[model samples]
Every structure is written in structure tokens, then in C-alpha cells.
Target: MPMAADDIETLIRTAIPDAQITITDLAGDGDHYAAHVVAESFRGLPRVRQHQAVYAALGGRMGGVLHALQLTTAVPKE
Candidate 1:
């Protein structure tokens, strides 16, 4: 089954409690999504590492239930 947007947000928030997350259903199928995440914790991390953090939050559901995720990460503007 495809994952729910709320579930995705919850999982990410669980991993990064301070994250500001915006999830959009890209294809309207519930499988493809775009996530824009901003967090103070992302500061100084490389882009790949930031993406890894969000993927880790998903707990191995990336290629299975979650499918494609178009992710963008940014450190909060100070």
C-alpha cells in the first residue's frame, strides 16, 4: 500500500523533531511525493547527507511502500 502524507510527516518528525516539513502528492497516486524539509539540524550537512537523514526517517520504506520521493532540504534561514 502507498504511504499516507501524514505518516510520512510523522516519520520524518520522529527522526528530526525540529523539522519543518511540507509534503505534496506529486502524482495524486499517493506513491509519488515531493517533500520540502527545513530544519536547523540540516546546517553544515551536504545535500546527500541531508537527503539520507530524511530517508533514514522513512525507515527502509523508500523503494517499497513510499516509492518515489522528490526531496529538497534546506537549513532554516536565520
Candidate 2:
């Protein structure tokens, strides 16, 4: 089964409690998604690491239940 938007948000929030997340279904099919995540914890992280954190939050669902995800991460603006 494809992952739900709420599930994705919940998982990320679980890992990064202060994340501001926005999820979009790019294909109109639950399988493909785009996530924009902003968090204080990402302040000094590299882009690759930021994305990795989000991936980790999903618990290895990428390329399995959740096929494609276009992810963008940023630190919250002051």
C-alpha cells in the first residue's frame, strides 16, 4: 500500500519535533510525493544530510512502500 500524507508527517515530526512540514502528492497518487521541511535542527547541516534525516525519519520506506519523494529541507528563518 502507498503511504499516507499524515503518516509521513507523523514520522518526520517524531524524529524532528520542531519541523514545519509540507507534503504534496506530485502525481495525485499517494505513491509519489514532495516534502518541504523546515526545522531549527537543520541550521548547520548540509543539504545531503538534511535530506538523509528526513529519509531516516521514514524508517527506510523509500523505494519500497513509498516509491518517489522529492524532498527539500531548510532551517527556519530568523
For every candidate structure, what is the RMSD over all alpha carbons to the true structure, in angstroms? 0.5, 0.6
| lDDT (Cα, tens digit) per residue for candidate 1, span 1-78 | 999999999999999999999999999999999999999999999999999999999999999999999999999988
| Per-model TM-score versus the true fold | 0.97, 0.97
Tell me how far candidate 2 lies from the true structure as C-alpha RMSD in angstroms.
Answer: 0.6
Task: In angstroms, give how far residue 9 of model 1 lies from its true place.
Answer: 0.3
Per-residue lDDT for 1-78 in model 2, tens only?
Answer: 999999999999999999999999999889999999999999999999999999999999999999999999999889
Screening candidate 1 with a backbone cut-off below 3 angstroms (N, C-alpha, C), the clashing residue pairs are none
Cα lDDT computed for each candidate against the true fold: 0.97, 0.96
Worst 10 residues of 2 by lDDT: 25-34
Candidate 1: residue 39 lDDT (0-100): 93
